[model samples]
Each structure stands twice: as C-alpha cells, then as structure tokens.
Target: MSGLLCYCRGGFEPELAAELGERAAAAGHAGYAVTERGSGFVRFLTPAGDAAGLSRALPWRSLVFARQKLRLLADLDAVDTRDRIAPVLAALQAGAVDGTLAPRFGALLVEHPDSDEARPLAGLARALGNALRPALRKAGLLAAKDDPRRPRLHVCLLAGDHLLLALGDPADSAPWPMGVPRLRLHPDAPSRSALKLEEAFLTLLDDGERARLLRPGMTAADLGAAPGGWTWVLQRAGLQVSSVDNGPLRQHVLDGGGVEHLREDGFRWQPPRPLDWMVCDMVEQPRRVASRMATWFREGWCRQAVFNLKLPMKKRWLETSLCLDIFGREAGLPLELRARQLYHDREEITVLAIPTGR
Candidate 1:
C-alpha cells in the first residue's frame, strides 16, 4: 500500500500518527500509522486508493500535529553514496510525478528526519538537490522555469542509506523545511514566550492580513501577562497593551510605557472597553481556556485572538479536537479558527481565532 508521510516534532510520533490515522479513516481512506520513537516523522499507509489522491482528500488545516505532509511516490533502499544522485534521478523520472494531476514539479526539496543519523544528510541534500533538479529537467520531468503553483518533489533520506521520495501539493503542504522557521528572539523581549506569537503570525496569517490587521496603535490585552512575554510581542507589533496578571511584569516591560499593568485575574478580568486583539498563554485546562476565548469573540470583546491551550498527558489530539469543537460552537456563526503545535510550545498548542461577522 502507498502511504502519506508527515514531518513533526521529535518524540511526537504517537500523536502525529494517531491523528493522521484517525483523519485518514474519517476521509474514507482507512489507514494505519507507523513510526519509530524519536524518529521525528510518521507514515500513514492506506490499503486502498492512490496515496496522492488520499493526501489531496485530507484537510491540511485540520491537522494539529503534522508539520509537513507528503504523498509517498517511491522508496529507495540502500542508496549508493558514491553516485547517490543517479538512483534518485532514475526513480524520479520513472515514478515521482503526481499521477492524479500529471503534475510538473516546480522544486525539488531534499529532506531528512530530525534524528541524529538523518541530520548529517543535510549536506547530502544540498549536494544532490542541485544535481537532481537538472537531471529531472533534462529528462522532461521538470520545467525549465519553475511554476510556483506546481507541486514540489521531495526526497527524504532515512536513518540509513535508504530514502523515501514523495510529492506534495503546494497548497496542502508546508512551504518551509520541517514546518519550522528559524526566528531570532527579540533581544529586548521580556521572555522567550514571544516566539510563539511571532511564529503564529508567520504561519497562520497571510501578508495582506498581517499588514492590515496588525497596524500600529491598535489596542490589545494580554491575559496571564506576568513576565510580559506575549505583551512584549504585542507592543513590538505596535499595539497598546493592557497586561493583566496579579504578578508584576518584567521591569523593562513596565518601563516601555506602552503597557498598562493590571493586578487582576485573567479568568475574571474584562477590559474597560472592547479591544482590537487579545492574547493568552496561561497554564490551565485547554477546555477552560477555549471556552473563555470563545466567549471573548461571542460577545465581541475583541476582534481577534491568539491564545495557548495546555493539554493533558494523554489523548492530546482528541482533547484538542473536542476543545476546538466546543470553541467553535460557543463562538457561533462566521468564525475562523486555527490551531498548531509551534516549535516554541511544550505540552501545549497555540490557537488563532477571528470572528467573521455578528
């Protein structure tokens, strides 16, 4: 059976596999997931249907654990390093094209899992990627000029000399390697928590929405804002922030003068007036946080929000699904929501919600 391959954070093979298996089953392509511990990846094998078609059928946004999704096209075992590019090129020419779309690949991405054995292949990918692209072009497998709309070809080096070659729809797969960006922390930010919001913006919103929605002078509230990590992120984005927490904020955050320190409980506090945005990173049951976030939108307390939900030790995917479902119901009609396991989060996931209408 052909399979779908997904890249995720190390040690989360179980969550990624379970979520993919469940989602694949729900999509009418029942499958089983397999991965090794600390492998940093998972594969869902479907007994029926073409893998590319199955990948297209799955909703990319609904997946919480998967970072990059690829449709398995070929698997090369015991690659010859002396002339590694030759075998890979032969496989691509023969079978890597998307059967469903007769797709012409725009780019070739040579990737590897985050395992220690796979990390060394970064150099191999860099060396062979340049070699294989031209070989593909020479063989008429790729166009002379790239078309951004076309799918990307992926060649993933496994722990050994083996490799898994795949194709991914540009619309359905992450545009970045391992679905993570290398972002530097703001030197002046109060805490490292600021990275979550930065990544959320880059991953969740488009360029136009970001420019229009995050303009200077917009007002925001940061709940559980002690140490003011999220608040600093908001202020850096040029919003006036109300930092609500019983504990004091970092001295620099208070000294910045864009923040109003409020000694109040996040669960019970309300802004004196409606604000443009709200952010939360409190440690609490995901359900309680989701319910509160929904209430903020349901009553028009804020136009949009980015928050974190701490998950229990088990059934994290299921708990996340159920909580988001509850959030959707409580938020009512015309609401948009997205949740992701960011590189900066641990035992928690971040959520972004926007109300489309009344």
Candidate 2:
C-alpha cells in the first residue's frame, strides 16, 4: 500500500512520524511511519487494504506536527536528468487517485524538503511547477485556476534524480508549504518574536474561531514577557494585556497604555478575573510548561491558551507526547488542542488549547 506523505520542519521528523502513527492508530487503522532526522518529512504507511479510505478518516485539525498530509501516488526512481518532466507527467496520469478526484485538480505545488541539503532545490521546484502547470492543463489534468472544491497535486523533489508524487484535499491541506504561515514582523511591534503569535493565530485557529475568540478588547496575559514580543501581538489584537516578568518589558509596550507591565513571577501570578486568553512564551522544561498551561484550563483561569514548549535535544517526540497526555488527563475537559513547530520557532513548538464547552 502507498503511504501518506507529511511535510514538516527540518530536524523534527521523529516528532511528526510519532504523531501521525499514533493518530492513525487511534483512528482504528493502525500504521507506522518512516522517518529520518533532519529530512523534514515523514511517511505513514497505510494498511494493505486501507490506503483508499485512510485519508478520509484522518482528522486534519487534530494533527500537530504535520504541516501537510498527502497520499503518495508515485515514487519514481532513477529519474532521467534531462527528461524528468515527461516521466513526472506520465506518473501522475497513471497514478491511482480517488474515482471522484480523477478529473479535478485545482492547484499544482512543486516542493522539496526543508533540510540543509535540500535548500538549493527550492528554485528548481519552483521552476518545475511553472513548466508543469501549463502542460497539465493542456493535458486536461489540471484546472485553469484554483477551485476550492477540487484537490491539489503535490510534486515533491527527493534528490537530483528522484521524486514523489502525491495528492491532497485543499480543504485539509496547508495553504503554504510545510504548513508555515508566511508572516512578517511588524515594524512597530516590540520585537520580531511577535510573528510567532501572529503565525499561531493564523495557522492553529480557523477564521471562525479567531473571529469569535480574538475580538478587539479581549483580555490577555503574557507570561515571561520581557521585550514584549508576544505582548505586542496581544496588543495588536486589541487585548489589554498584563505582561508578567521580572525583567522590564519594552518601553513602548508599557507606554501603549493597553498593557500593564508587572514585575512578577509568571508561575505565581494570577489574573484578578478569568480572562479571555493567556499566552506563554517562557523558556522552561517542556513538561513543566505543559502542566502549567493545562492547570490554567483545569482551574478555569482562562478560556483559551497559546504557549510554547521548549523541547530537549533527544527523545523530543516521546517527551512531548507524554506532556500533552498528562495535560489532557489533568485538564479533564472537552478541549480542542493543536500544536506545531512554526517557522519562527526554534528549539520549541507552539500549542493552542481551547475549552470547547467546559
């Protein structure tokens, strides 16, 4: 059976593999993932009889580590250096796709992994997509423009002469490569780190959730908020923030009047009332931070939370799984949880937990 291809950040292939494997098993179709460190991808192999239906059963919103998920249709070997395009087109045309998806391809995305060795191929991927799109359309395989109702074709370059072809539902796939939201640092924000929260909002939460949860004038607190990076993000969202830290926040953040800088320990500080949201970017053990964030939900201190978990150098996937499991048990709520290794994040992953009804 063919496998599901997952695009992820470099150096966290193990984490993505573990997550996909567990999610697939939990969904009643047990499977395993093949992964390599620093490769920026994982492939979860489907059961021999289950490949056709596996994608329909997997919940896109529940996945944390995978940026994009596609069912692999072809794995071409020994690609001709001078005539790769013809084989690629042939492979795609011959590939097994859903009977319903046979004629409707809304978009074509050519990409490579985000590893150090693979970085140079980005330009090549772009060039290939440019050349391939018209050919596909001419062959009646691709639609002229992006149609939300149709699926997307994914061509991933493996090496100079190897490649993988896959297909994804646009409704479930990442709009951008590796599921990373392209965000720019606001010039007026206290620090570039603000982009993390911005990206988190755009990626982790859907538009409906954001519209309802992040309304202007919502209250928030930023823990360990020195330099006011995350605080600046909250401010821009129109949340009056209590920036808690021992070190001083950026002067501009303090002067903004929407934020109240408190020289206090984030661990000990408590909001005067239940707030709308809480965001933490503190540098601490992944488990400890997860526990703290979970406690806030358990105690009903905040309605929602977005926090960072600083991972260790080894066994990161195991450690993160344990932490999230503990948080789920401790929170004891019907919670909607999502986590991702964002482009702006280094040595950490961001988590968003919202109490759906509890």
Candidate 3:
C-alpha cells in the first residue's frame, strides 16, 4: 500500500522529506514526490519501522495544522473507484458526515471548471459530511445533543481530492466570549493587510492550541516587534510583554496592560531576566535570526520561542535545511521544535521551539 503525505510550502515538508530521504537511502522503502502544485503530494513505500515513526511524529494536531497538509485521498481508487466514491457520496447527501466537513470543505472546488463534472465531485464533498457526521457527533467535534454550545470549525482542504477538516481543535475552535473579535489593522478601518493576516492566523490557531501557546500570567518578549503583530497576540493572551523595536507600535497595543514598549534595536536589546516566551518577526536575513535564536537558546534567555526565518526566493528547500542544521547544532540546547510556513505567512517559515530541559 502506498502512504500519502501532504506538505505546506514553508512547513516541515523539507525536514520530512529529508527524513524520508535518509530512510529511503538506508533501504527502508522507496520515496518519491507524487504530485506538486499549490500543495505537495509525497508517496512512500511503507517500511514497518519507518512508517511507525512517521505515524508517531504526525499527531492529529499537526495533521490539522495549515503547514502540515492533510493526508487524505489515500488509494481511494486502489480497489474500486466507483465502490469508494459511491458510499462517500451517499453519506454526503444523507448529511451523515461529521466534523467540520459535515457542510463539506473544498465543496467549492467542484464548482470550478477544471474538475471533471461527470465524476460526482459535488457529491463527494457532501459525502464527507454524511460519512463523518456520526463520528463527529460521537467525538464532540460537533454540537453535543441538546448542548447549547456553538463552535466554529476550521477546515483545510488539501491536494489530491482530500480534505483535512478540524472542529474546535483548541487553536481555531470558537464561540469566543464576545464572538470572534474583529481586528482592525488600520485605526480608521476594520480591514488592513496585517489585520487580515492576524485573523487568518488566529483562525488557524484553534482555541485549545491558542490557549496553550498564549497563556495568562506568562511573560513574553518580542524582538523586532515594530507595529506589533506577534506582540499583540501575546498581550491578548494575557501575558506581560516587553516589545523591543526602534519603530513605533500600534497605539492600541501600546496602551494594553502586561505590555511595555521598548524603543531599542531588537538584535542589541536583552531582557532583564529570562522570559517565558520570545517571539520574533524580523525582516533580516535568515542566518542572522538563526544565529540570534541560537544564542538565546544556548544562554537560556528564553524558555520557549516562536520566530520566522525568511527564505531566499530560490532553492527554498536547501535554505530550510541549512537553518535547521544551524538550530540543531548551534543552539547547544535539547529542543523540541516544529516549523511550518503558515497559511497567513508568506516568503518565510515559522519556528516554534521549546528547550527540552524546561
């Protein structure tokens, strides 16, 4: 059986590919890139041990993340295309599907001209709801029977006629207290490029994951936090934040509690004490950021970190590998790390790392 893997552009695909490459080189199994387009599809001839490791590393949470791409459309036609398609469509029409796709994600794709109309593509999206509805109801991915809670689910439609739908996954899970807050990027208007990106990022975060990453009473330091996007997230999470930037921050963020604006160079500024979290969204070269992160991690200046490394326009994969190597070797700290090019992000990759000792 062939195992399918989907990867987001700036996420861990390169690392995953590198891992797969090593496995293939060692005669674990043959691995190849099956399809590459907006998203990527990789196929691996499953080796017992290697497959197990992959399964362990890929938690359901990661599967739900925008960077990791969903693993769906697995050999749907392997046995009998018609046989598989029929049941899925029937389920959709019946509204028996569960999870976020009960309404069906990627149903929009069927409306596009490129897809074959004769293939019952429309029915397939509906079937996802039909087929998974029971499971979702049971697992609480949907509303509980007579439970007055309304939760918003976030769905990611991946490549290969597959879907990755998640409901209330903590990061994007909803029914926020005041309803989801509308963030205004421009002081005068409700819409701006940065605000839109923030909303998109929050939607991808899900409530639970957001809570974990952004906890109350935590102390955070933001490097290169001018105009404060990442800092805004941390402050809203109820963490005390010291924002380091020579540039100005949004007035609202500046007025927020648990927040202190420091007008200093990010690279040169140092926190008075170790912080719970350190976030950076600088525009400098990737190596410079990597070097600084390594120094902080090595010196135990921060317990956990989330930062972005801008990638060169060409040879993105190679560049990612190089940065990973620097962090792994130079940090001189045992670390648990995950990196991905988020949906709300462009031309750069986000890294979330936690020191192992902590």
Q: RMSD (Cα, Å) of candidate 2? A: 1.9
**Model 1 CA deviation exceeding 4 Å by range:** 98-103, 143-147
Q: Give per-residue CA lDDT, model 3, range 201-272, as digits (tens).
A: 464345665666667998989898877777777776688999899888888777776789999999888888
Q: After superposing candidate 2 on the true structure, give the runs of residues whose Cα lies further than 4 Å from its correct spot.
A: 47-49, 98-101
What is the Cα-based lDDT of residue 12 in candidate 2? 84
Of the candidates numbered 2 and 3, which has the greater lDDT value? 2
Please, what is the TM-score per model? 0.92, 0.94, 0.63
Q: Rank the candidates by TM-score, best first.
A: 2, 1, 3
Stronger candidate by TM-score (1 vs 3) = 1
Worst 10 residues of 3 by lDDT: 106-115
Q: Scored by Cα lDDT, where does model 2 land?
A: 0.82
